[model samples]
Target chain A: MALLEVKGLSINFGGLHAVDDFSIKIEKGELYGLIGPNGAGKTTFFNLITGVYKPTSGTILLDGKDITGKNTIQINKAGIARTFQNIRLFKELSVLDNVKAGLHNRYKYSTAEGIFRLPRFFKTEKAMDEEALRLLKVFDLDDEASVKASNLPYGKQRKLEIARALATKPKLLLLDEPAAGMNPHETAELMETIRFVRDNFDMTILLIEHDMSLVSVVCEKLSVLNFGQLLCEGETSTVLSNPEVITAYLGE
Target chain B: MKTKSKLIKPYTKKSFITYALLIAVFTIVQLILNFGKMSFMMQSLLVPLCVYSILAVSLNLTVGILGELSLGQAGFMCIGAYSGALFSSLMKEAIPEAMVRFPIAILLGGLCAALFGVLIGIPVLRLRGDYLAIVTLAFGEIIKNICASLYLGKDAEGFHLSIKSAADMNMAPDGKMIINGALGLNGTPKDSNFTVAFIILLITVIIAYNFVYSRTGRAVMSIRDNRIAAESVGLNITKYKLITFGLTAFLAGVAGVIYSHNFSTLQASKFDYNMSILILVFVVLGGIGSIRGSVIAAVVLTLIPELLRETIGNYRMLFYAVILIAMMLVTSNSKLKGRITAYTNKLKGLIKKEKKGEIK
Candidate 1:
């Protein structure tokens, strides 16, 4: 059985159908990709899947449990985590604290315990800090952990977002345009890092990318979306070479 | 090994000295201030200053830490002050002494306020930004109007006499009851002092500081920074926002209790739109997220109008308005803009330094 299945998902914004009858299924531990030209409803699909927008009609099942129309936080707590196309780090917070914010859901100490500085509060806080540092180190961001997230270089900021998502301990991770703005070298490094995280953490990844080269190199399977419809789906090389996929890119 | 030592060494010594010095100075100044025999006016002003500090700091937890605007503090305070006054009055004859009833009254007042906080927060917290502020402001006005119509105590004829006129009317000493609409409840025990107010203020600051520094605090800050991003990581935005609202209201309620007990009267007019705005100004005038800023602003704003009282006389409010407008302009334009740029530059420099250190 597939780890995630979206069946006949459709969403509308008043008169316009933003995402129409989209469906996709992924097996456990698979690395999948979604690619489309600009204005092709790629992001709208991601938004629907991540619960930023509830579908007007359809069902989203994760590991055989329906999770449609739930709030974004609820979806996240159910073991799905995502990064934005634009990096959305807490700009005013320190790098480590941004990662720690993701660990907030796991905290067990009550407000009373925290206010009184109970030993249990301290223990949990220490563990969170250590876990945040460990994630940052994996992304090579530990050296800049104390600095404000906004001050990090663009590449490092992108990596920090991934690290924060990881801190949520998600079983399935979604990346929205993870390599939107990057030099070739940075993009190549991010590709390897993405692969490394998936293998090391044993996580399933679903990604959206406009950069065909990066998506083609990293994703074993790819789906093509156009005008809120699925254009094609297959192995990366087969789907990329499809005539409809070629026509969509060329027309745009 | 060398890198670890370099990282760990300065934090330990610097933090230890900083904490020790702060404690010593605070204690010493508190001692010196306690020795003075102040006039009634001075005491009244000082008491309000401490009370406002608690209100401003608590409101900041919601507005600054949680990144939501709220205007229902005065409503919560009204709940606290009225409830506290009622509790103390009821227990005065029952309790052996006035002193014994004081602490119980204050606690009861705070708890009552907290209950209202949770009640109002559950619904109001669902809205964000200006929506929440508007709902809260309306709630505050509604509370004040409701309190204005309540007649809690009675007269000799058994007809519910207005609390304001109860003292003037002839009544048995044991049968005297107070609390009237718009007339203000009179003859409440005046037990609130600078020491008591400051102790509560101290406890509030300590609790607020711990909350903002904890994991829950970070979650609140993140929600303030970006609600969508915070929720995407599984932080329950609504739940945390309500928590902050409830906690802030609880503190404001405590301030209300202190105010009522100190003045020996409870006036519904004191908890109105003007008071809520005044507290908001305190939080904004101080850097919103800065605890020290709120405390300092509370003290300065409180003392400034008082210092001008004799000179400006009844026009003290005009002076306050002028200063508030001037500070708002300065802080919004040059001061905060400059600070932001400076802070960004400092963060960049720190990053570079860390990179260099890592290279070594």
Candidate 2:
């Protein structure tokens, strides 16, 4: 069974169909790529899958379980997480704290325990801190753990966002414009990190990217989107070379 | 070297030491003021200082940490004061010991305020920034208006409510009116003391400090930083907002109980729009998210009039306006704020070094 199955997904903003009749089947452990030009509904499709926007009509299934129409947080708890096109870290918070926010759900303690300084609360908190620090180390941000997330450089901030997402332990990870502002060196590093994350965490990944070099490094399958419809989907080399996709989107 | 994350865990030694220092300082000041035969004005300022400090810390949870603007703190305070006052009044004959009665009254006050908190929070949670502030302001006005005209009387027949006067109400002659129109609650019990007020303030500080170090508190702060990102990470934004707001009201209500019991007479009109704004001022001036800052701001602001004495009477209004503007400027200006933070960090480092020497 496919890990994620979208059937006839559609999202309409007034008269405009921002994402229309989008469907795909992604198997577990596969690295999927989504690419398109500006205003071609690439982000709209992502918004739909992550439950940020309520699709005007569609059904989204994860491991054959229908996940359609759930709110963003609920969908996330059901094992889907995403990074933003623009990095969204808790700007004033410590890097470690930004990651710890994701690990909050892993423990079961009441507010009373928090207020009263219960032993269980302390135990869970210490463990959460360790895990959060470990995640920061993975992104090479451990040294900056105590620094405010906003104070980090642009590339580090992007890396912190991904680190924060991984703290949620999602079975499915979505990367939206992860390499938007990176130099080639950082882009190369991010590609390797993406592959490492999939292999190490054993999770499915779907990334939206304009950096074809980065995409080709990690993504095994590619789906071309243009004008709210799927232009084509196939193995990476074939889809990237499709003449129709080239003229409509990839050419420019 | 990575320092362990202090987010939402239990009390660490560092935080514990800070809290202990605060308590010690407050206790010493209270003792000196008590034993030094302080002037009546100074003595009078103590309770208000504690009460307002409690209010500031509670309001800070919503404004600074949760990043929501609330102008309805006075409404919650008024509810707490009345309900707490009602509890003491009704228990006057039954409970001879004021000590036994105060806790019950405070708890009842906290619960009543939380009830209103939930009621208002349900709708207010959907709003952000200016809209939320306006709606809360409206609610504060509504509570004030209701209290101004609300007349409740107790008789052999039961409780009766009338808008105009207690005389026209269908009740026995022995019946007494608890609230008079525009007069507010008549003759609430005077059972509060400086010691009790100090203890309550300390408790508020502890709970607030611990809350900021809790998992739920971390979630709430995350929402403040970035709602979409907080949500994307599976944090329940609404639940955390509601919880913080409700707890905020609970603490404000406790402050109300402390305030009302200190005086023989209570007026709902005292907790009007200005009261909420005053508390917000303390929160902002104290460095919004800092509990210690809130405590200091509340104390300093409460004592300003007394400290200025004779000149305060002539320039009281102007002085407050100018002071408030200056405080806002200091907080908002990046350079000024940076200097203050740097100075404080240097002082903190010195203190830590001295402490280490002591241990050695």
Q: After superposing candidate 2 on the true structure, give the runs of residues whose Cα lies further than 4 Å from its correct spot.
A: A250-252, B5-14, B335-360
Residue pairs in candidate 2 whose N, alpha carbon or C atoms collide under 3 angstroms: B8-B213, B8-B214
Model 1, A75-97: lDDT tens digits are 99888999999889999898988
lDDT of 1 by residue, B174-212 (tens): 564567678767777787887778778878888888788
Instruction: Tell me the number of clashing residue pairs for each predicted model.
Output: 0, 2
Q: What is the alpha-carbon lDDT of model 2 when measured against the actual structure?
A: 0.88
Task: Show where candidate 1 strays beyond 4 Å.
Answer: B1-40, B97-99, B154-175, B311-322, B335-360
Against the true structure, what is model 1's DockQ? 0.52
Task: Compute DockQ for each candidate against the true complex.
Answer: 0.52, 0.68
TM-score of chain A of each: 0.97, 0.97
